[model samples]
Target: MGLSHRSAQSHDHWFVTERDELHRSDAIELNGRSALNAAGIDIDDVVYLDLYSCFPSAVQVAVNALGLPLLDPDRPLTVTGGLTFGGGPGNNYGTHALATMTETLRKDPGAVGMVTSNGMFLTKHAVALYSTTPPRDEFRVTSPQLAVNARPRRVPTEHYSGTVQLETFTVRHDQQGLPERAIIVGRTGDGARTWSRSSDQGLMAALETEDLLGHSMRMADGHVEEISAVSREGLF
Candidate 1:
């Protein structure tokens, strides 16, 4: 239908700032639906899909934004099993997806396929639809930045010392497969966003096994003071 960009990213944070109710990038859904609608199609009309997947989180965000079912047996999210599984040619995931979509469309004769692209911490996004059938309209790129920029933004806070509710987080493991560190994003009572990192073994372990979204915690100056009281007192 159409191709588009989200505009320049935030200077303080690398991740997308324009998020929807679910905290997924508004640009991802906007461009995906715009492309489908412009092509005179809809989600029902698409048979093949490849969502950008440099990480599982990216795929999940796109899936949620596009309202795709998380457990659909008929529609596999990726034609190549995604970048983590499909093999990443560095930053050329979109081209890989396009090549795979073309090959898949060739086999299916006329089925339509969609591929989503991402850049720099999911800050930039583009969507494209393809098929064996020829195009009826000329190609072009689109932008929904004006709409995106109008959405509510969570200002990044550098120094914070108080209670917070976890917005999102990721835990990293060491070479030995043990919990090593965690990168966390949380919001204060006033809704400002703050990011912090912690290498506490207990904290990282707890994060891996639990759903921490909305969990309360304490942070000081871009650091997780302690997670020892997490389960009992909700501070990490």
Candidate 2:
């Protein structure tokens, strides 16, 4: 199944779900729910459940759906070394968690170990469990009811239908006193899908000198680059 992690902003989320017309998040939630359903895990079988913990939202959504309380004071919150502790490598690093749990179960025998994997900036999620002995506890996490009930409502309806062609994209220069941000330049579209164009003196000047985030920019072609205009509407 596909997966996605959207930013917390309403605009950014709309770009992906509405403008891009992607349903990756919906597919991922369904896939997870299907796996739990097929396993026949009841509340009793679930000794513990650890949702992917990369960011706070992931854990919050899962607990709310499964009706699990937040961390218990008596129980240690972390069972494995966190990412900060070098628990694993990037996306695929979660494989390392499997290796760690294998040894932990071997020694504990009847004890259980749980690990959660977060992919693509919390866009995807995974939960794994291990026990030297056959599991006597049941799995009770229900279908992703929270997501199903709350569907996406806002998305970009219009693409940059304007006549814009991407000519080139430039990473911020790191020369002696160069700016510390990336920049792109191309032709402006007719206002259809998102488009880019050459940087004008006005835009180039800002990128070359100013500090801005999530704004629209255009560069004018001339003897020297000129920034045409800047938008503060939070377009990154």
- lDDT for every model? 0.72, 0.41
Tens-place lDDT per residue, model 2, 140-181, is 333443553356433222223322333324445457754444
Top lDDT prediction, candidate number:
1
Model 2 lDDT, residue 134, Cα: 52
**Tens digit per residue, CA lDDT, model 1, 69-187:** 87788999999988977887778777788788788888887688888887776777777778777656665556656666666677678778988877778888879988788988877
The TM-score obtained by model 1 is 0.79
In angstroms, the error of model 1 at 110 is 3.0
